[model samples]
Target: MGAEYGQEGLVSTSCDIYSFGIMMMEVFTSKKPTDEMFTSDLSLSHWVSKALVNGVTQAMDSRLIRKDEENFFAEVNCVSSIFELALNCTAESPENRINIKDALAFLQKIRLEFLVKLSEN
Candidate 1:
């Protein structure tokens, strides 16, 4: 459940989007929101957000970093786009959050760009 869900006690599509964002972050960083390292001030979201300021490479899983060295720049761009989408999905205000359709379109665009980059290599 997201903060909005707890704060408002409302069930809506935005709630599901928030959960999806959390799952995407977990998949990328291999860190869960409930991890022992996460506290009230230092959460998984905060950690990733800080790392993203530096580069997506800093936020990504070590395994991905090792495997995608050939396409590092392209991969980082794609991952950064994905993280931005996740943040939008998890926005505190439901009205400000992106819907599933737009999220999917953004993801597809990222994928297409990645493929084009791969072909160029």
Candidate 2:
């Protein structure tokens, strides 16, 4: 369930989107929502958002960076876009959250851009 579902008791597709966003964050950052570091003010989402302000390298999984040193720029760009998408999906307002169709489209675009950059390197 999402913030809207928990707060308003409303069940909708947005709830699933929120879950997806959280899952994305977890996969990218290797941090679970229930991690000891997360608190009321500092959530997994907030942690990622703040880390991104410095650099995606600070927020992303270390294994990814270590494995793709040659394509670090493209990898960072793709991960940053992914985190942005996750933030949008996890918006507090259900109406403000992105739909599945849009999310898929955005992800596809990110993938294509990443591939292009990878090929250029």
Q: Would you list the C-alpha lDDT of every candidate in the order shown?
A: 0.84, 0.90
lDDT of 2 by residue, 34-100 (tens): 9998898899988888877987778788977775478877888899999999998988788999999
C-alpha root-mean-square deviation, each candidate: 1.5, 1.4
Angstrom error of the Cα, residue 96, model 2: value is 0.8
In model 1, what lDDT does residue 86 have? 83
6-111, model 1: which lDDT tens digit per residue? 9879999989998888889999888888889899889777777877797677778878766547987888878888888888888878888899999999889989
Task: TM-score each candidate.
Answer: 0.91, 0.93
> What local lDDT score does residue 69 receive in model 2, on the 0 to 100 scale?
79
Q: Which prediction has the highest TM-score against the true structure?
A: 2
